[model samples]
Target: MTYKGNQTTWDKLSPSLQQKIDTDLSGIRQTVTNNKTEVTEHLAKIATTENLGHIKPDGKTIKVDPATGIASAVASTSYYVEARQTAGTTTYDVNIPDVTAYKPGLTILLKLLENNKQGAASLNINGMGVKSFIFQTYAAAVQNAGELQGGRVYQLVYDGLYFTVIGVQWVSSYEGGTDLANNPYILPSYGAVGKVDAKVAALQTQVDSKSTKDVYTINIPLISGWQGLAQITREDNNMLTLYLDIYGGTRTGGTKIGTIPAGYRPVQTYSMYFGVVTTASGSVSPQGAVISIYGSGDIYITSSNIQHNIFIASSFK
Candidate 1:
């Protein structure tokens, strides 16, 4: 709500003796009005929040930050060992088997090639970027009764982006199921590997959504009263002409009344400042004509860069 600056706070009171005190206070309201208007207008011009990332396109990409989370390189190839028994469990020192054979408990190297290049480096597994797991060495072996366990189960986590498994080619093999002399496993036995997506990938999608909402609220205050007389204007003293153009007849081009450039700058359109205003019950002239504001581009963001002019009712007529 607004008020005419002709009456002062004290003058509004009912007087019994021709005003308890004599004073010229009519202009007092003008000062108060101007003060209040300036404050509100100033508050509107403030930048609440902004998506600092939007200013730069590269900011959208996620880079490994060593200062925060753990940053490590993805493995080109990782291997694990698994042991089994055909007869009784024997305590034997085993090593990684060659890539030519297939034997239970034999360490097989899983090569996670990026962009088909074994030396290619990436941040996550699949196309979605999320660093939850990395390729590492694992060992599995079968144990004797009460000695340890039955058979060792090794787990290999190949977590990286852009690298999909084609097939596991056997490198080599070793001693067969048991201690038999004739039992011998060969090499080059290949197997199929399935691809799996990481959970961190899904979590990143959620984070982006929340970030967008936060950015929206931050720029709201910067665009307050966007369509009113507080809008940016040019020319030293053309208030009357500008006012007439905006609400004047269906005039077009530079001849229109409110023909000021939409942005705070003298020229050029900052996608953020280019928009049309929809008014419902607010008038530029005589009385009530509702005005609803809408933006075409990133108006809120652009509005923050412009200077706004707020005039109290007394400043005019």
Candidate 2:
């Protein structure tokens, strides 16, 4: 018989039933208090623990200082092994306690301190089960036990099968952008502008040299780009044919510059003839012209001299 809110109903209940209800209430109160005390004890242990060994998501255990609530992973052990070939120590074997202890993404940095040895030194990584480890000074395609140089820092990471080289320090060169202060690499400056200026200067010099013209003798080859006048005098001629071979001018055989007949020879004494030669025209073939006289004429053709004057232009077409 449970107790009701009404005092009349409670009074109607048997004393034995009422005593049972009171006993049940006392047990519930004690259980609640015990649960609160257990919770407080667990919280206190969490707050007081100096080193909280918590497993990280990567399966590595991190130690947390409960007083500061700062969590930190265990640092990798650095081995500064001295390898000198002069001392007959060509290879240094690194002994890792357990190969299975290494997980993927685990990194270890090792420094190889050389002792000014005469020959090269190498490192042999041991204790990693069937897995092979490759060490190199720079990134390479092949895997091998690389030669160890003095004062070089190498970073190695395990990929569950092989310990691959991911980074290196004290290298001679780097491929990508790096800090200019300590790195040996240099950035290239703009050089195309300087090259263009040099080319333009050379072209200007050529143009300047092409602007002068000079006179030449027609008997010799004519110049490439000039036109000149020549005077030919024939004092005595018996169907004389004079070849006017300009340097770069042309004319047909029938093209006559002057003609003298036998009847007018002694009477005239001398006959003057003038002709023009130019290297600028495209109609001229074979780059020359001929002056001839034919008429059964005994005439003296003379003009200052047999060789005529020709001028050559400075500029080329």
Best model number under TM-score: 2
On residues 225-276, what C-alpha lDDT tens digit does candidate 2 reach at each position? 3234432223233222233323222233222333333332223222234444
Assess every candidate by TM-score: 0.15, 0.27
Q: After superposition, how far is residue 9 of candidate 2 from its true place, in Å?
A: 30
Q: Once superposed on the true structure, which residue ranges of model 1 sit more than 4 Å away at CA?
A: 1-17, 20-27, 50-118, 125-317
Q: Distance from true position, residue 137, model 2, in Å? A: 11
| Candidate 2 accuracy as TM-score | 0.27
lDDT of candidate 2 at residue 252, scale 0 to 100: 32
Error of 1 at 170 (Å): 32
**How high is the lDDT of residue 74 in model 1?**
27
lDDT tens per residue, model 1, 1-317: 22344457546756742242333344576788899997886555443332111222432323333421232222123454433321221322234433223212222323321112112122221222321211232122211232122243333333222222222122223323454345466322222111113356667777877743231101121222233332332333322111211221222212211222333232223221222332333322222222212222122221221122322221110
Each model's C-alpha lDDT?
A: 0.29, 0.43
The top-ranked prediction according to lDDT is 2
